[model samples]
Target: MDTVIRMNRRQILTGLASGSVVAFAPGCVENPTLGRSQLILVSEEQIAQLSAQAWQQSLQRERVSRDPALNAQLQRVGRRIAQASGLGYDWEFVVFDSDQENAWVLPGGKVAFYRGIMETMENDDQVATVMGHEAAHLAGRHAAERASQQQAAGIGLGLAAVALDAGDVENTAQWAAILGAGVTFGVLLPYSRRHELEADRFGVDYMVRAGYDPREALDFWTSKAAQRTGRPSVPEFASTHPSDETRIAALREYLVARNYI
Candidate 1:
């Protein structure tokens, strides 16, 4: 009975994988902002619904700061970056009352920044640096792209598992786990790094267009790099984000190429 169940599972996975690939192939669409094609299997309406749910959950889960000053700063910086993006999202910015040095943007222009990060900004240009980066993520449609990639990878993995099972392979579970890790470190992580780099480059462009000095982006990232000294380092291949050194260098190179430095 167990063997029959296993065989059925393998057959189901195999069929799903084959059908998914054919169905999702046409999802490749050109993104004018990034000047590249992106796999966007999920529709904008679907992403927006998910984003709204996530935003509401975040508001319920995290203590939102009521500080008028912090809220004003975020709104000021966020609005400018949103306008500069030209994506026409109904933008909303909120300050989470956390001491974490982090900020993120959801699809449909829901932006959140931690008070810790906001307090560290020395000027509005520094604020713009972070705002522009979050806005760039929205402009790049990274959330949707990432979802599409994961869906595709799951299909590929399903097919691989079926092949292993059909071959009567030993240690099939171990092989499947290894393949999963390979997909993470090889495909997903690399694309995430690429997304970060893209955001950095275009974020600087948005900053410039919004009348903020792009040089501050250099200083901001360099400071972030300095703060990482003496910390345990994850290899660039295994991490979703580029190393601080790599990001700083890339930003500098881009700024110089665009004559922003």
Candidate 2:
């Protein structure tokens, strides 16, 4: 039994390493800007198509801002960053008439910002900070890569269970819980934190190239961190994003490393 268990473990590890679990070269492609290879299961055309559907749905459900001043400001800042992004995406920036301090970007450069976040920004540099970050997610191919990784993980877990069964190992509730927690905290959450940091670093670079002050990025995040102190707390490992402290610290380190100040 001991020898059989050892053999099964070896087979599982060998399968994982030999591309039986993850075909490293298939869906993986090198992103020149991020200088990394990403697993992109979904094609750009599919993402764009889905984005268009989402954009249309949002337009129907959300009240778009007609504030002339806000519209003009968003357009001005968005154009500068879009030009600097070098991603060649057809960027569309819209301001939503809401008080939620939030912003998001869809694939193919569809971006929406709430009036709440806009009102909080002291300057266009702050806007550029967010825009650059969202754009970096796109240029970094994060959405597709995330989907692919999750899919692969699901498949791998299923295979792992099968392998364990073949080796006469029980897939008990405790084992399931342990494995689930390990995947969530050790792999998925950490990957998300890394994505956030990568976006932050690339965002700062985009801000600088777009003639926005990189210092404003730091200031903006610091202000956000202060705001979060009064809000409900979320554990870093349980959340898909890193804590504000972690993000801010990483941003500062990256800024200093790149001499962005």
- Note the residue pairs that clash in candidate 1: none
Give candidate 1's whole-model lDDT.
Answer: 0.70
lDDT of 1 by residue, 36-77 (tens): 999877556545555565566667777899999999988888
Computed on alpha carbons, the lDDT of every model, listed in order, comes to 0.70, 0.68
lDDT of 2 by residue, 67-106 (tens): 9988998999999998888878888999989777777777
Off by over 4 Å in 1: 1-26, 155-180
- Number of clashes in every candidate structure? 0, 0
lDDT of 2: 0.68
Worst 10 residues of 2 by lDDT: 162-171
TM-scores, each model vs. reference: 0.80, 0.78
Looking at candidate 1, the ten consecutive residues that score lowest on lDDT are: 161-170
